[model samples]
Target: MTISNDLFTRAQELIPGGVNSPVRAFRSVGGAPFFTKKAEGATLTTADDKELIDFVCTWGPAIHGHNHPVIRDAIAEALNNGTSFGTPNPYEVEMAELIIKMVPSVEKVRMVNSGTEATMTAIRLARGYTKRNKIIKFAGCYHGHVDSLLIAAGSGALTLGKPDSAGIPEKLAEETIVLPFNDLSKVEEAFSNFGDQIAGIILEPFPANVGLIFPTDGYLQGLRDLCTKHGSVLIFDEVMTGFRVSAGGVQEHVGITPDITTLGKIIGGGLPVGALGGKAEIMDHLAPLGPVYQAGTLSGNPLAMAAGIASLKLLLEGDAYSRLDKMGKQIASAIASTASEIGLPLQVPQVGSMFCVYFSEKRVDTLDDATATDTDRFNKYFHTCLEKGVYLPPSKYEANFISTAHEQGAIDRASEILCETLREL
Candidate 1:
């Protein structure tokens, strides 16, 4: 048996589902998940000693690729000082300052340990600020497994076919109004029906968790306007898109401001980090300034702050986003052109370095369309590509990421492998 198979056998005894995360179990892909021994530049060395050209990019944080020297050095430097202080540190202040400077809508920012924490706090803060109980979330937008946000969520929850997790109170779920993404009319209807009760509306602006669906034309702006008209807070869940899509994120790219923005992934530079930022008036509603209680001892740990600063600085150094976009187009176009040549029904939705391949001919713009993607074919394609030394997200309902380390050669090689795999299938 392969080392990964052996490892899985042992892991299942100790860890639930043989993995820390649900998708890592490879249940959707029908295979043993390979554990990574090490990673560098756009590749992961599997436990079986195979080097796979990684397209998962550690689920959207490896913008500079794994084990980047710059980030490593920053972490090492921070380590020299200390790991955790429990008291406020300089790195936290600097990190918050950097976020305020970069994200246009974020005037004040607070750090947390994970995207879940950031999002959960944002919800509470919004409710506290608006003095309302209900929150509106898109059907497939995963806001980090917060109880109320778990209904009709995406990511592993979608992959496992359990959008609504068990053990969450029914009343909590009811307070979260799940709506179809990219549909402004439904949003308007929700507001008209429960305008005074809506504390906020949280969305992934681009909805990367459910396979990278984009907003319809003027759809985001329409949400902004509706939120304003209803006196509800607008929360952009950029945990996946922030800093990775652009320096200032989708808000900066699209020019629509949000009252609160939740960020993680690249902002932490592959470390466990998350942040919530917004207009000072709303942010001040959090504890110490207002009634919303949110606190984390490990929040803004020195190592994460240092790593994030290095990652953001590197992104700012050159035309990184442009380069990433160019590379993204190369991979995306290759997949599209090949699928067309082979008469395969494929739709590749891409923005900046994030994209997903839907094995359907129809354009995917809503959660319904993304949910209708062909998983059987995607599983077959995933295994074939992995056998050929290319690794993508294990499930069809996840976004594939590209890193700065993925140059033209890697892109070309991955494209060829993807095309050949498609042709064979």
Candidate 2:
């Protein structure tokens, strides 16, 4: 048996589902999940000693790619100072400052241990600020497993065929109004029905968890207007898209501001971190100043802050986003062109460095559409790419990522392989 297979056998004996995360189990795509020994640039050296051209990019961090020297040096420098401090450190101030400077909507920011924490805090802060109990989230928009945002969520939940997670109180789930994405009418209807009760509306701006679906024209702006009209906070869950999409993320790219923005992924520099940033007025509602209480001892770990600062600085250094976009298009276009040639029903909705392949004849714009994707064929395609040494996201419901570390040659090779695999299928 392969070393990865052996590792999985051991992992399942201890770790539930043989994986730390549900998607990592590869249940939707089938087959044993390979364990990675090391990663560098845009590749993962698997436990079996096979180097796979990584398109997952550590599930949407690694904008500069795995084990980047710059980020590594920053972390090493911070390590010299020590790990976590019970009190705040200089890195926390710097991270907060950097976040405020980069993301247009985030005036004040608070660091947390993970994207889930950031999102959870944002929800509580919103409710506290607006004095309301309900939150509206789009169907298939996964906001880090916060109980209130788990209704009809995406990511692992969608992959596992269970959108509404168990264990959440029925009343808590009721307070979360789940609506169709890319459809402003549903949001308008929700607001008309429960305008006064809505504390906030949280969304992924571009729903990457459910295969990178973008907002239709004016759809985001419409939500912005609705929140403003109702006095409800608009929360953009950019944990996936945040700094990876742009210096300011989708808010900056599309020019629609949100009251609160949840950030993680690239901002953590592949470390465990998350932050909630927003108007000072709303953020001040959090403890020490307001009633909403959120705390974490490891919120601003020096290593994560240092690494994230380095990652953000790298983006500010050159035309990194443009380069990543070019690479993304190269792969996305190749897949599209090949699928067209083979007359295979396909749609690869891509933006910046995030994209997903949907084997559907029509374009995908809603959660239902994403849920109804051709997973049967996609399972075949995913395994074929894995065998050919390209590692995409394990499930069709997840977004595939590209990074600046992906050399032109690597991207070209990946594109060629992906297209060839599609044709063969």
Q: Lowest-scoring 10 consecutive residues by lDDT in candidate 1?
A: 366-375
lDDT of 1 by residue, 1-425 (tens): 99999999999999999999999988888988999999999999998899999999999999999999999999999999998999999998899988999999999999999999999999999999999999999988999979999999999998898989999999888899999998888999988899999999999998988888888899999999998988999999999999978899999999999999999988788889999999999999888899999998999999999999999999999899999999888889999999998899999988899888999979998778887888889999999999999999999889999999997889999999998999998
lDDT tens per residue, model 2, 1-425: 99999999999999999998999999999999999999999999999899999999989889999999999999999999898888889998988888999999988999998999999999999998998999999889998888888889999998888998889999888898988898898899998999999999999999999998988899999999999999999999999999877889999999999999999988889899999999999999998898999999898999999999999999999799899888888889999999888899999988889889999988889988987779889999999999999999999999999999999899989998999899889
The estimated TM-scores of all candidates read: 0.99, 0.99
Each prediction's Cα lDDT score? 0.92, 0.92
User: lDDT of model 2 at residue 178?
Assistant: 86
Candidate 1: list runs displaced more than 4 Å. Answer: none
